[model samples]
Target: MGFPKHLTSAIIRLELPKNDGGLILTKNLYLSCDPYMRSRMSRSTEGSYVDSFTPGSPISGNGVSRVLDSSLPGFKKGDLIWGVINWEEYSLIKDTSSLIKIQHIDVPLSYYTGILGMPGVTAYVGFYEICSPKKGDTVFVSAASGAVGQLVGQFAKLYGCYVVGSAGSKEKVDLLKNKFGFDEAFNYKEEQDLNAALKRYFPNGIDIYFENVGGKMLDEVLRNMRHHGRIAACGMITQYNLDQPEGIQNLFLIVAKRIRMEGFLVFDYCHLYPKFLEMILPLIHEGKITYVEDIVEGLENAPAALIGLYSGKNVGKQVVAIAHE
Candidate 1:
């Protein structure tokens, strides 16, 4: 494949395999955007857990695809699946382990890129396993309008908890409260003081805080956590773009309040994927759970969609609809 002149530029081209054991896939759909992809764009000293996208090479991301040709067994033609792949119409999957077979198609195929895939599992493990939420507890989620945050808020509400969410815009705040059924929703951008904002909503202090956007928001949350409060550290979106991350001055509060803070990666809990599906699928069928998606049309709009995540431009789960499955 020929390289584009710019770092952000992505162009499609045909190329022969440089090695064997590679599988070719026809890209059925592409996920529009995610904040993490921004990190991969830069040339950094810190190595990526997932390999960085190379210049002139086809950019890859989590997408739902169909197997076209395979050297590997089980994954034959017509197999529907989702995983990391190129931005082009066709992709050569060098690592077959990254691909997973899609067994159920009764639900929307786009779901495999978001809700039924990485973000869904992230919410499940972070809220259930890491936070250890209990019934009737108070739960707060930062970036509540986002992909993972939206699901977290809903799951907490379903567990019979008082859920409050903070989002950047008025529309997002309204969606959190009205559509997602959060007990209360506030526009953090309007509030001058996040600590005071939290106190106004959660007078008793927060029992569980789902930490999505870090920096000052996290610092304020630390001061407001009740005794033995659990803080599930997901992604720190606030600090992701900054050259120097903000310092949390209220570290002593964790010790004083006996708060428990744990950081987690969803892949660490992949074993629980089946169990998560078992728990969440029934909730979906009963209409106890609702998912929101902000979908962009075509692969060409993918770059803008991904970049929108950082600016809080997306209302819900950001996905790119490449083709109808």
Candidate 2:
């Protein structure tokens, strides 16, 4: 694939392979623009779990694709799929395991880039395994309007927990409350005192904290946690872009409050994907769950879509639709 010289433009030229392994995917759906990718674009001595994208190479991400050709077994032409792929018109996936066959087509294909994919799994595993929520528990989600946070709030509500979320904008705050059915939502940008804000919403204190944005937010939430509270440490979007990440001041509260905080990556719980689908798909079909997506049209917009996440420009799950199937 050929990219623009300046590395700032959206236009890309696809170079057809000399030989096909019989596995070719024409980008037919959307790609997720997540906050985590921001770190990957930078060159740092501290290596990331995933390799950074090399300049002039087509950027890759989690996206929904449709098979255009197949030499591999089980994958035939016209199969709708979603997985990691390059930021171009088409991608050749050699390892078919990365590409999961889409079994359910009743819902929109874009959903796989978010609510039904990595973000969904992150929320499920973080909440169920790390948070260990009980019915009637009060849950707080930071960066609540994001891909993972939105699902976390909904999952908590489905579990009979009182859920509150914190976002960066009024629109996102409204989305958390009105669309996602969060018990209450607040715009952290408008709140002068975060710790006080947490106290206001969760007077009894938060039983579970689905931490997505860290830094000051985590510090505040820690002070407001109920005794024996569980904190599911998901992604820390707040600290991702910083040259120097902020340190939490109130960590001592963890010991004082007997809080149980644990961090997890979705890969650790991949085995539970089947179980997650069984639980969430029904809720989706029955209308018990709602998903919100902020789709940027075409692969050209992928850069801005990813940058929008940090600035809170995205209203919900940030996705880049490469092509419509």
Candidate 3:
């Protein structure tokens, strides 16, 4: 166990460890910087599903890596895999539970950290399953240009839904409407009243809300939901770093409008990964779906890359490039 403290970038040199038969040694290729990781930085993760990071130790998150040597069964040298791996250059993995061997390389390998991996699965399960989206429904997404939110907007658009999204900047707002094919997008920071902004984009009222950000935004979305609308609570990036989470004043609207808001964790739905890939891989190949990544080179810059996510410094999926395969 390690004490919790504010995040700071540091590098420590260590000699290569002798890999025992049970361990799989890997050279990390890419690491994902996601908003959910902030919760792990806290000293006590009381309500968080994931465990807190041990301070002064190598923190781990979703990463793409290639196996160099493996003595573990079901894994061998030269296998490309993605899952939870250490932030360091070389990791001797003892836990194989989260590891998934990559079967497709036709797409960019760095995508495993974003659209093709956890974020992909997250967007799939949240929109299709939790939201029960119907064609022609009006949809709104928060943090719209991010890893998971981008995919959710595209998915809703493909499903024939009228899609709108909210991002933090003009650049991201442009990307959502121009690049991601969103019906409309707004820079939330520029909006004095989010409720009015949402109403302007969704005059018919939102039928589905892909919630990546919470706090004041959620309070407004609740007020804008139509009867029997669905809300998929994928993440609440705004509240992760706060000493106390904000309250939603319009939660009563959920009952008044007969809305259904469900929170989900992607890990619990991993069984659907095969189904998700079957649907998404074709979309990627046909250019029906597009993914953007903000790649930061080297392990030393990983901390800043992760920190950038909270401040909306990243334009898309933030990835730290550690090594080339």
Ranking by lDDT: 3, 2, 1
Q: Each model's TM-score, in the order given?
A: 0.91, 0.93, 0.94
Worst 10 residues of 2 by lDDT: 1-10
User: What is the C-alpha lDDT profile of model 2 across 1-325, one tens digit per residue?
Assistant: 1222233445423433556655554555788887777667776738466777787777777889888766677887888988787777766677767778899999999999898999999988998889988999999999898899999999899899999999988889899989999999999999999989999999999999999888999999999999999999888888887778999999999998999998888878888988999998999999998989998997777777787788889988999888886
Tens-place lDDT digits, model 3, residues 73-121: 9888889999999888887788899999999999999999999999999
Clashes of 3: 0
The TM-score of candidate 2 is: 0.93
Off by over 4 Å in 1: 1-22, 45-48
Quantify all predictions' global Cα lDDT against the true fold: 0.82, 0.84, 0.89
Better of 1 and 2 by TM-score: 2
- Number of backbone collisions per candidate: 2, 1, 0
The predicted structure with the larger lDDT, 1 or 2, is 2
Query: What TM-score would candidate 1 get against the native?
Result: 0.91
The TM-score between candidate 3 and the true structure equals 0.94
Candidate 3 — which residues are off by over 4 angstroms? 1-19
In model 2, which regions exceed 4 Å deviation? 1-22, 45-47
- Identify the candidate with maximal TM-score: 3
